[model samples]
Target: MKNLVYIAFLLTFTFGFSQKKTESLKIQNNENAKVHFSDGPALFFTNSDSLILQVHPQAMLIDSLWMNKLIKSPLYDKEQYMLGDDEILVAGLEELPTDLLKARLKYLNSKTPFKIEYNPQLEQVIRTYLQKRKSSLSTIMERARYFFPMFEEHLAKYNIPMELKYLAVIESALNPNARSRVGATGLWQFMYQTGKYYDLEVSSYIDERSDPYRATEAACMYLESLYKMYGDWSMALAAYNSGPGNVSKAIRRSGGSTNYWNIRKYLPNETAAYVPAFYATLYIFEYAKEHNIKSKERAISYYATDTVQVKRQLTFAQINETLNVDIEVLKFLNPQYKLEIIPYIKNKNYILTLPIKDIGNFVSNERLIYAYADLEDTKVEKPLLELIKLDDKITHKVKRGEYLGKIAAKHGVAESNLKKWNNLKSTKLQVGQKLVVYPKNTNPIVTAKVTPIKEDKDETTYYIVKLGDSLWSIAKKFTNVSVQNIKEWNNIWSVNSLKPGIKLKILNLLNDQKK
Candidate 1:
């Protein structure tokens, strides 16, 4: 009897300890994952891992959870779904009956210019959203309440189909500041060159691509142009994801087929999934009531907000204090103002947007607010840097042993931009090929002959982390340096470790560090 009692006590103690440990681990992980930076403006990372299916020049990498779910489903082997070499797979887990889905899709097809007829792939995408991403649909719907109106206004002006607003839903999951891994940014995921071409200005102090109104207008115009090129909305969407060149190639490869489904095998894998994802988002949002997806309550709407012109330079910090507006609300309203400072250059008036109630307060006390902002500016230790406007284009002639990376680095431009500007299909460059470049920096470093420095493998240097420094940006400052290399060298895996003034160890590189 004593032995039994002792064993019971031991088991209870062990179980209690295990339970506490598990709870402790959960709390610790949650804390680590949500480490907030209070020192400066918070960097809002996109809700991308859950939603966006990247469709860029490179092969698409999707969320592993979605991929795994598809792999386990019987729909994975369906011939009707053209699974790409890079695995364009998504299957709904028997959540909704096929007949019901087909009927709904038929309704949707009749309503939109897009060819949204029922297919196994389309059904899989819709079911996947209904099953796995149903919870997120509520939040997405709430955001749509704020953004869709603006999207619709512009779409109507351009005479584009109103349902085309759903494209933004999948492109960004309704996050205005969503940035893809390849540097495609904003709600529509516009590449730097594409954004520039659309006259969406990207300056140090402002990225108009993140501006809801401007970005929406740009998207409508671009979509309108694409529609003109390909007489089909589906084909236009395919061109939007993979460039028209790729779409044209696909059509040619598919024996002059203009239909998207006919050329699905020839198109990029990501483009194949892109149209279906958009359709899935449209279906979920359209039939949210049937799916029992409830929208979360949103306090603010685009209509409720109004803009006031700033007479002088104003910082969000100053405005937050003086107007008693939340800094986050100001950030949300004026996303174009990077670094949260509205510059007051002569003849270049930058507007400050605020809630309708706050607009009256701002306009009434404009002088006092400017006085307060001026006083605050005087108290600052460092004056904000002047915005570098990218206005000039320079031609770079490719020399022997020269590649896109080498040329781009020499001119201080992105390789993607170089490719886009020159319309080069691939990274390969022939000798004497001239590339037009809109350099971010007016003065690019001229390559100079360097003295060779013998270095030990153990020798390392430290980099002082700046306010806006990211691991990716830091890696780009050195020759042949990669983010992975920096991660391993500094033993710093988390972005939380990258606070200002933190010194990161970098290995010595050939040709020293980039100027």
Candidate 2:
């Protein structure tokens, strides 16, 4: 009886500790946190609406507002969403009948070994496709009109099911230039090493994975190989998402079961979502009309375009100006042109696909187009060092007691962005580590410019310096405060003299902050 009571007491203690840990996670705090997020900072983007700065999300409606602001921010143009990131950001949909879905999936089933099953998670993803993310899906549908035909042609060569093309839909959403956090690229989302194994080249100006035709062929081959190895297309689909090695690991954990659903519990988080997303996408694509979803009309399609060989190196701007074609349209059609330039080589031919209507003019005016170089960009030479020294970047060295959130707040950037740039998995920090900050395009880059601290009629406040607080860092908290000013006001000469809890007088800070 005494032993039972002791065990019960221990269980109660562990459960209470777990509750406390979970509570600490739900509330925002800076100590040893995985994700260092802060609230109520100045604007991060320059061209964004002021409401973005005012928006806060603990409330229900404000949650969507915060996500909308992020999509508009400059970071949206730079940062590519990986699997986990998409699951969070992609919007949701209302629930549908499970029986209807199973019937539809079973009806659409073909040569591919697809398993039509329903779970709450998969249902949620189906909702995301049919309801919440309707606009995004509509846009993707338009792009599919241009890309899907090409994918079908290539995939047919290998005799892989047409359904497998939807895997690319889940991989990159049909964006040929899409790049993942783990360095996957192209419509197929091939990583650097995998792309190389398939003979895709990567250079400063050329990444073959961004080429629609070549990468699609490579993806088909990879999928075929995966299907051969697994024999079951469902497992192959899972294996394709996570490497075969991961599928093997999942198989081992599931006691030699080859079924995806059976071994799904042992698979990686992203791969688990990946298989369902692919099937859910297939369902939506087939029954979109029933769901009242309509594909948006695309400005261009493959049937209306023609490919031509370029003998000379040319920029998209030159082509756009010479042919009177939209530069954005050129970019969309030819995503492999990384720097907006289609490079030519002595031994190899480079092809450019253009609208069929413009091909005749392009052939006639080839000589004039070659000579129409925009020399304005050539006058100034780009320095090697200048690559890192951008107007939008800020360099900061970590100090004691400084974590991700504090630095992000000071510089007006997101902590998640910081983690992305630095490839950090956690919010843990080390003293004296240098961090590079990239602010939103709409926000001014915060630099180390010291201004004169204004006085509020001889009023003063005392600050108890924290562990990582230097004169420079403390000064940043107040406008127009500087390291030199702190020394002058406190009569301190050595920076090393600062210790935690040491009170320092800051002049006119309280009232000066109002202005």
Candidate 3:
């Protein structure tokens, strides 16, 4: 009887200790896990082991007891939650379905450098991320191959770490045309002013911020400068995403801890997670094969073209005409030309990228291409000169956000003139719509006097107003009298209307006035 009682007591005490230890382990695991909210999804990280994620509340209980046992194994590394090859020991486990077991094994054997460790606290975060993004590890991997090469090249040129290429993936999924709601544009999402500083020109006809090559070059220069300042790739990437000023301030606030991990707490919430997200993306891309993620089929390949220097201005229309190439094909190859016109100055040259097959054709027709471009320029010049000659009589294309008053002010004509020119009853004008204005005539006035001409006296001429003449319009016609002076001389109350074919007085008019 005494032997039996002692045996029972020993068993109970052992069970209690095991239970207490398991509970303690669970608590420790929860404390180490930190939850992060991202734009697409929430991420959870565990300090004690690899990350464990749940896509929903139901997923929380998904093989929970089995995962708990796996977390305690020696094969799992605490910081990375990576499982060594030999760590598959589980006892007293029920045989799961084949598909379920396969998934579990795949997750466990993932070779990605970044992984979420299994734990209760991380379960909610995982669920949130999965629910919000509806994205899987496979999808992210599939899209990476398309953009990674261009990013790698640019990063290399800047001498930045190849790992930083993942930052572009996070900022924009290699989409060259990505634009943010805040007017941030391009793959790197640079604002207008920032782009200008980096020599990415934005004009009425072209926005270089949308050009992949130029924007990438600008991004590389900016990143290189940031790296020079911080002497750390991670910090440099952080600064690139969220300005150097912010990163500098964050470092200052963190008691001079230049390390991203150390100063992460002081950085903006988005930036704090940005570094980790980049790392996670890198891990996903590098180890995609191990995760059974395959690359998606892309219609276009990046290495199919080579660049050539064009020393003369060339329009896409001209290229199409001379080279017999499609405009879309040209656009695909040379996306940097925003206006579809390479404005190559005398000393400046544009690097025109063309396909390997098309290079010979482009070279063959180079002169014809130049002539075509010159012809186009000449055509543009003629119209402008004609419009100038017509002065206030010509129509103007309404730009975006332009009103009748604004257009009138721009052309140095009254709003009424613009309205009358366009026959517009209202001030509203749609973008690209035309508005007519009689340009200010600048002709020198000649006054006809009935006085007898003395010897050595100059003969004066008087100009008669035509059927369509206003002070502004008349000033524009002559190129002599300014619109202001035209108004002053005529003493017109409102420059809205002027009767044409009226004689105006002028003195000492030269014969070379027509030229």
Candidate 4:
């Protein structure tokens, strides 16, 4: 009886320890599964039953399987103690093979989210997102580090939700120069008309839609207005994605379903996906550390900068010379100024962002800098008007069955000149190629004699046929001539079928000798 009791106690203790170990493994696996770090590759673990690792700063649990892999992989070296995978485990970060860690990160970053069970519709959408995400993540991570701080600052100033930062990630992946197929542009993806409504200047010289600071402020104001109308964050976000009109229509269709999910079915396809994508992105970013994704620290300079008001036109090149700074740095600071020319009209202040340290240097040498910039602008005078005039030349749309030579002859210009003006390398002319026929006068003036043709009152009016002309063209030669005229007068409409040297009748004839 004593032996049996002792055996029972031992079994119970073993079972309890086994349960605890399984529970620990589950927790670690969950932590390893999450995606983290906007810039680094995603990290994940395969075998949750092996070892345990923890994230620093937060001390989140990491799965042992991943830890073991990291330690054992080629990424880790056994000797000379590098920060490789082998040393990572030896460094007491985890008790698993370091080889697993390397594999886990690769898997996590590359893995697509689990597909919805028995739902083909949702699976298709998920697949598309995963495919697009593969290429997009790298670009987004690169640009986000530089832009996020400015975005956060602006959002905070407006008392807006910081989560709004994800909107840019969805809109253009933080690419300020992004232009959509439909012409929507910038990091926030504002259309031209909408951008103009928000006071974002759009011109040949500059597109303020690409200006990170200006566009963010505009987006915030627009979002604020939407929030005021909808009274719901989700609805406001939907309205922003698919316009307020569509959201209102959806609401009305759903019998006033204020919930996003309730009205999601009635929303536009992309808008429905937009909200989910936003939520997924927010979740991924929030839980990145758990996934073992390490962010590469980049010390961005110029965070502490002051904007100086300048009221004169200044080029970045000029600024570089005058301020003794790299032109590239100025470009990084002022991306809004396309052509690198600051339009500083008199009394209209252009805010120039400069490093705080350089503010003193600028103030002391303001006059000299201004003078130097003015001189540079004058010396490097661009023939902007001439370029515009050239662009404004008349265009001739090519018609069907017409070649370049025919069109050139019709417009009284050489084929080569037309090609040169239109930047065509070949003689091929498509049906709608807008061939430039007229160019600005760039030739010396020449005098020529003017002779007038003499009109014959009773003479036979005959039309001279030129190359590529046919007799059928004679019937349609005169505005009032009928097809029967060619068959009646010349007794041949078929023969008039567009042959060279085919003459047709006209009302009267004019002789140059008589004039």
Q: By lDDT, who's the top model here?
A: 1
Alpha-carbon RMSD of each model:
18.7, 21.7, 30.0, 30.6
lDDT of 3: 0.50
Question: What is the lDDT for 433 in model 1?
Answer: 82
**What is the full ranking by TM-score, best candidate first?**
1, 2, 4, 3
On a 0 to 100 scale, what is the lDDT of residue 436 in model 1? Answer: 83
Q: Over the stretch 418-506, how does candidate 4's per-residue lDDT look in tens digits?
A: 65577664344577877766532220122112233353557556766544232222333343333333333443312213334767555
Query: How does candidate 4 score on lDDT?
Result: 0.52
Please give the TM-score that candidate 1 achieves against the real structure: 0.58
User: For model 2, where is the 10-residue window of minimal lDDT?
Assistant: 48-57
Candidate 3: worst-modelled 10 consecutive residues by lDDT? 21-30
For 229-319, candidate 3 gives per-residue lDDT tens digits of 8777778878977888899899999999987877888888767656655654554555456444564323233453456788677766556
Residue-level lDDT of model 2, residues 15-82, one tens digit each, is: 75543422110111122221221121110111211110111112212322332232222222212222
Order the candidates by lDDT, highest first: 1, 2, 4, 3
Candidates 2 and 4 compared by TM-score, better number: 2
Model 2 lDDT, residue 109, Cα:
69
**In model 3, what is the error at residue 385, expressed in angstroms?**
12
For residue 86, model 3's alpha carbon misses the true position, in angstroms, by 40
lDDT at residue 68 of model 2 (Cα atoms): 29
Lowest summed lDDT over 10 consecutive residues: which window, candidate 1? 22-31
Off by over 4 Å in 3: 1-147, 196-211, 290-295, 374-515
